[model samples]
Target: MESYGDLLNNNKVIFDDRNYGFWKSRMKSIIGGIDRLAWKTVLEKWEEPTIKDEKAIHCSVGRKQFELIQGCETAKEAWDILQIQYEGTSKVQSSRKDMLASRFENLRMEEHESISDFSSKISTLAQEAVTLGENI
Candidate 1:
């Protein structure tokens, strides 16, 4: 059997509209979730009794989400934000394996499953990230 990365790199799903849409929606949802988490983290550190310009904060967070979603910067940054967001999650305390497993649950599922599964899932995700390159 061909590997997941091989299939992804081979353009197996490149022309599939449904798959594309699914990935797009999934990515949007993931980014939104991450953004909200990050915003909450900022809130924890924000010492103000109440936010005066909530609209500005929302807009700024939205824009940052856009940039990160669009792949304007390195995946390392996105991953960092994800870690931060996960840190702010209600039950998650340590920013370690448990945290990553909780945050990227889907991705973590294949970690101990199979190389093919791991490679394939990651490959498709990487492709999605690449798609955001010019849009950022």
Candidate 2:
């Protein structure tokens, strides 16, 4: 089995702006796996980690992503910044959810589309909705 240090080094979760939901889940898993306190550092505004959770976050992201969280003092602050940047505010999220719901309601398989292709489209839409914190 890989050591914890090995896991930390090998399983860094890099965030690309396009898939914030997937990246957020992966990063949470990685940090939580490292130590509960480290994950708590991201969730709790005031909790500090013995290990620098911010460093882990910094090392996992690229230069552009780094700029988003560089000014953060706490790990939770950094996490929130990225979350807001990618997920937008709650109002924006609600609007996005409405748009996605409309798309899902109107989705129809094209005449030339295969069943598999149509199913894939549905799956993608469903996944995106789930990423946005929708129950669908």
Candidate 3:
């Protein structure tokens, strides 16, 4: 139930291109928490809420990241650019998905590894796969 103002004062939602997956999720949660229409503006066509949503995204990114979407007219356009930059094109995504599947298939706990450590490794791989639009 956080307000838009609360998000403005929070730095945790900022994107710096280091962890695009995490940043994207946080941004979606914050924007959607404020209003579902605002989140829709980033996914659907441009609308009345686009300006505010675009501004929120524009302000939350670092200088380098800002430059990537400075010319974008809508939040959705900016989001698409950022996604492509980090996630790559569909072909690249397919390659990554294949690699992740291979890793998952070959993944095995080491003899000395703790159960928690092994679980974490599996979770990380699963998250990365999910981030790439894979069901794994």
Candidate-wise lDDT, in order: 0.40, 0.79, 0.83
Model 1 compared with the native: what TM-score? 0.23
- lDDT per residue, candidate 3, 20-128, as tens digits? 8788877887778777687886888876533354567888889999999999888789999999998999999999999999999999999999999999999989888
- Clashing pairs counted in every model: 1, 0, 0
Query: Which digits, one per residue and each the tens of the lDDT, describe model 1 over residues 1-136?
Result: 5442333344322212234334334434433344555344433444343533222212223343534434413333444454344234434443333433443445665436788887777665555443333111
Instruction: Return the top candidate by TM-score.
Output: 3
Candidate No. with top lDDT: 3
Worst 10 residues of 2 by lDDT: 45-54
TM-score winner between 1 and 3, please give it: 3
Q: For candidate 2, what's the RMSD?
A: 2.3
Model 3 weakest lDDT span, ten residues long: 46-55
> Please, what are the lDDT tens digits per residue for candidate 2 over residues 1-136?
5566676688877777676777777788787887667677577756554755456677777789999888888877888888788878999999999999999999999999999999999988888898788966
Cα deviation at 126, candidate 3, in Å, is 0.9
Residue 19's lDDT in candidate 3: 76
Candidate 1 segments whose C-alpha is farther than 4 A from its true place: 1-16, 19-106, 134-136
